[model samples]
Target: MSLSIGLVVHASRRGVFEEAVESLSGISLKWVTYGHERDIRPLVRSLVDGHALDGLLVGAVPYRACRDVLPPRLPVAVPRSSALDLALALSQAQVRGWQPVPVSIDTFDHEVVAEVTEALHLDRTRVTCLPYDDDQSVDDICAFHQRSLKEGSGYVITARTAVLRQLRGALRVLNGSPVPSSIRSELHELVSRVRHERAGASGFAAGVFCVGRHGRPGDLERSRTGLLHLLRATPELTDAWIEDRGRRGVLVLGRRTLFERFSRNWLVVPVLDQARESLGVRVAAGFGVGPSARTSVVLAERAAVRAESENRPCGYLMEDSGLVVGPMGPGGPPRTGLHRDQDDRDRDQGDRLRELARTVGLSTATLSRLAAIEQDLAGRTVTPSELADAMAITDPSGRRLLRKLHAHGLASSEGSAQTHRKGRPTGLYRLAIDAALTGSADGHPLTAV
Candidate 1:
């Protein structure tokens, strides 16, 4: 099936959008375009819920603007302004006879600007790089540019499209757009990831096995060694671990097909029978199938307990609908079970949040911290001071992180709390957990994946 991808860009950048569409012609894609950056959140929510787009490609809109608003699981690709784009902007400035002696550049990363400056053989001292944060308004940006010009900057190069539009006639503006090649690269990556995830969502089966000595206390040590040896030799098992020495429970992970095959023909029965005969040991196995590895592990643990209760040398399968099918000894009834697709949506939501963290360049530690806070204080708003304490960072760093979240639409300032003293009110913020899960500010329930 052709993958459906939503393309978001400003309406004014129709030419660049068209160019991107043309460049991606070789791929089997159903491109849905959302022209206005301002209305992207609602449009993307509609596309995700109604049209079923596999992924999203956002251009023209800053990454921060769309990051928090879009559903976390809807793989989003945002193009970074490339070196080529900077090179072209510089070329335009030189063509217009703009002196490079004193240049004012705004909104581009300081590191990138430095690299470009060195590549272009421009004097670093003459260039003033004024990178704007998410809180800076157009007026604030324009004022910064105006101040730079008045302070002896002969030319201004800006990456902010709005600032460029407002100051074009007044300043020698070089508009920065994303490089087409960079956009194509990110799109290719997004498509590949979506394809992989779609394939993985089919679900897999896993299990846990409890092994114990049936004969005497002396045989316990021997049984553990034999069980570990057998598990290590089993190449069919994708993952195997002896979780507890005292309990002697082995966690095994594998494909559902393999488990089903073992259950139907009593293959596992014979294996356990042989172990009982040779080493005087018993094996109780429980199997589970789920949308994710974590969920499967949880179900497998429950299945293991049930297997021990049955006291049989047979495999048991736990279905998502809470049905248990097991004790498939020789000549048992044919295995019949149903798999539920209920948790697929929740798993997708998790995937989306991880992808969002990646796209926004958040560290794994930072993402984990956010998740912990969400879990501990479910519906309560948090202040920057509290968040800072939780994250073990400085107050300024905490405030900056909150601003970053707000910029990306992942958090909002609820209101301000009055302090007893005569200082400014403390800002209270709330994480947009519902928006992350449902893709709507109204907190609609997440749709099934």
Candidate 2:
């Protein structure tokens, strides 16, 4: 399938944007263009909501503009102004009989400008770097440039296309564009990342097995030992754990492709059969597929119950759409309908939860931990002590995590909890999971917290 990419650039830099688009001809590409950095956030949200693009290529906006406004889940590529671009601008200034000393630069961080200046054998003290801030307007930027010039800056170099367009012809402006090679490199990297994430979102399959009684302690131990040995021998089993120390069940997690391989080869059923034949122990198994760990666990538990009731050597595979596919014994058609019902209601719920994790820039593990805490609270506001206990982290760490969520607009502080007697009242917080996932948060685009 052709990868869809949205290109964001200022309207003034259409020529350079076209050059970038032309350079990406090697890939199967569908392009969507958005002009004006000010419209970037709304445009990107619209594109994502409409399912129009897989990734975004930020062509000519200031780096901070892209960083501050873009969604965390979308793969975004921003080509930086490299040292070579600075060197080329300096060379052009020298050719025009302009002294390289006392050069004023705008839209790049001060440290980067200094490093590039020193690397190119120029006096860093003579380079004045004015970094872009989201709060600063075009007039503020222009005034800064004018003030620098009045203060004896001989040449003005700008990396922002909007700033360049405004200062062009009126000043000795040396415009800097991201090098073509750099843009192509970033595009390749972003495309690879987008493809990987898309593959992950399709979900994986897992199974749980309740090891039946062997009627003797030693026999049961031997059976469990054999089961562990067999699991270790199966290279495709990504992870396996004896839930409740083998009292409740054994849980196994793996990709759908590997699970299908197990089914085709009769790997799991044979192992269970061997245990039954050699050790006189029976096994009840349940299988499930879902986008996240919590949903998989729930489905696997339900299937395990059904397997125990049926008393069958084979297990059932629960589809996302709620179809039960087996008493899947050895060579039982490999369980059909793996990806059926993409619009299944339960699958959509799991996808939305995973989307919330992505929107908050948290790992699935962290999201699960937070969900547990929320469940414990039972609609009451979260307190620091309760959060720390639920998350199994130190109080300070819990406070820091909560503050991070607030900063990302995923949580908000309600007043402090009332205390009868004490020093400082504990703070209360409410999470805005739905608001964040829907991109309706009041401030700040969600990014790494």
Candidate 3:
């Protein structure tokens, strides 16, 4: 399927981003341009409200400005200027007889500056960098450049257009915002994620709803009628195919996204409360995802049966891939449900994993998610941005998480990656979570030490 990507941009760098787009094909782009920073918030709001977008591409500045308006589920790619971009600007400064060292920089992360300078054999000690963050303002960046000028720095390098504009007349400045090949790579990655999500959205899902029995007469008929009535009245389930299955179960069929949303990402099902109070009976919902209707319905029925054993109205989800998530009551955070096939060894490993999380001062769920992400990485090193994207967290949070991981011996630096020649080398971290849990590369659990 063709992906519709929204491109939120500044008027100044339109050509640069458009230049990057020349290499990419098959994706429909809708541009949202803003002249000044103040215009970004409203412009992004408009883009989100009006457009049915599969993904969005925006720079760091614009992203920071309007992150609140962006949907949490929307796949967003924030393209950054890489160190290669910085290198090109430094080269231009050198052409003008300006040395790269003893320079002030703004908006670029300190790690990026360190990598680029260290690579070029420049003295990083002589360079000053002011990294960009949501708390930083144009005035704050301008003040940093001003201080650098007074501190015997020859020039300033800035990625922000506003910072560049404000300080250009007063300082010897270089524009560090080069559209490196990485931006295109980042877009391609976003497109891939969107396509993956689309494929998942089209997959078949079935929800089996079974009402709890009270040993009354006509229990089956009343249960069936009540389930159908509730399913039909619910707005979210309107698009789903509702069918009567056997005596006790009612099947609701639709796209995977529909159930994910209805179940609040499988954390909670709000309808359990509605049925409990209105129908005077407990309704257990179990959703299953599979390649076909028969498989999904079979799985859903099993899940519903599992939910039926609970004392109150609840729900559970069973995917064909062996993940079981549930007891999805109307409250608290969602916990990862154990797989039906979890053996004794697997259960022991899980216990050790929880202990590790506790030792590291993190919740079990967060650690479990980290373990899942590590598994997805397949032993490859990951940058903070990549880590953040995988975890659905902010970039700064990713950096902090990386630091925590490294500090706790859960992650290790595996040098850097220069995926494309033009940008700065991104530092990659190899996670050692598998080792931390098992105390060795093999499956043997760690002994107390």
Candidate 4:
């Protein structure tokens, strides 16, 4: 069977929900419609009774609605609604001079309401919840506006299509308007195009991993803009970085070839270098030949390790065959063993392992074991049991570990008859590809090795 996936969402805004699902055309797809019934029980029951679902794409539906419905094993991809949109809308709602006090009536499912409220910190008194209405006229909208004015507040209405359309116009009278989509769409499209370009290439032959210390609070933001400018100018280098709660300042490098095309932009390197220099900070660079994204991440660790060791204005570590830079000397594997390492080396190794785990979707302990096995297997062949013993894991545990790695696309399974004594050949697992952040396609690989 062509792996069947279902797209699920609230039935109120079936239009946008369907539009988003249709966007996935040419990919294996299916749909399970809910929200059409008078109550949500049938929908939940249907989900529980449905056949095995390979994947589930959910929109901004209430967590309460699906809390008991969705199976835990199904992979879910949700549209991360942009915070900028809510910010813009709330800003517009606050401008009292433009119109009477504004108010909001939202019938959005609980999840969406939580998202918007958490994002905007909006007060409940300012909005109403009438998910559906048959005869909402212009006069009603005017009345809401007048009430909001009388109360010295603004109306925040949340409805599916009908309310969104009505409020969109009503709010316009109050000068409450959505931020334009042109620039945002353009930027997203531009990034997407770059991803496609690099994905078509063989891979990133040369990469520069830069680590800067004594940087500003907003150095990451500035660095991103600088990299974008460089990309605009050079258009030969592709880059990826993550800015989340856990990792806001650190940067990661990856091979662009594994990514889609248009990702490689040569400008990312020197531009970031110059930006760092301008900030009066030192940085280390790691350059390698055809390094995989995983290798690049390790290389970045090497650069960081060297930079801290030297305690110089900046440290640079690049891997070009054997041309090593920075304090660590070269881009080789970590030499220190877990059993016999100083606290510093142990901590650094832990960081490296955690980073790898995040990339490959394995636990830190699993990755550490895998690294040990890789070291043992270097320049040699060993039995699965031997590898398992080296990592201090039972054979069954090793097999389970392998399965986890395979599911995350970090390793592949091969049917080796020599290893199997049973009716049919069982599969053995081996390393596949390194997970790196580049462009969108690279961000989400279609196939899991």
CA lDDT of every candidate: 0.62, 0.61, 0.74, 0.41
Q: Please, what are the lDDT tens digits per residue for candidate 3 over residues 1-449?
A: 56789998789888878888887888999999999889999988998899888888888778778878977567776655567888888898999998776788876655567668888898876788876555678898888777766865589888888888888778888888856476777688678767755766789999988877776659767867887887888777878999887677788999988886676455567667667766777788888888898888888988898888877788877767555665666532223453223333344565676556533434443566577668668899899899887666788878767755654568766678887789867678988887777778532211110
lDDT of 1 by residue, 295-327 (tens): 777787787776677666756555554434444
Candidate 2 structure quality by residue, lDDT tens digits, 194-267: 77555644566677877776567766676666666655665555444333337636677766555655553112
Summing lDDT over every window of 10 consecutive residues in candidate 4, give the lowest-scoring window. Answer: 259-268
Residue clash pairs of candidate 2: none
The segments of candidate 1 whose C-alpha lies over 4 angstroms from its true place after superposition are 25-37, 60-69, 151-153, 199-251, 255-358, 361-449
lDDT at 262 for candidate 4? 22
**Could you arrange the candidates by lDDT from highest to lowest?**
3, 1, 2, 4
State residue 59's C-alpha deviation in candidate 2, in Å. Answer: 5.2
The pairs that clash in candidate 3 are 83-424, 84-422, 84-423, 84-424
- Candidate 4 regions with alpha-carbon error over 4 angstroms: 1-5, 36-54, 68-73, 78-100, 105-156, 159-449
Residue lDDT tens for model 4, 324-437? 332222111224564234434434544444444543334333454454345435534444455456556677656545544543444444334466565534445455322221
Off by over 4 Å in 3: 41-54, 64-75, 87-97, 117-122, 178-180, 206-253, 269-449
TM-score of 3: 0.56
Top candidate on TM-score is 3
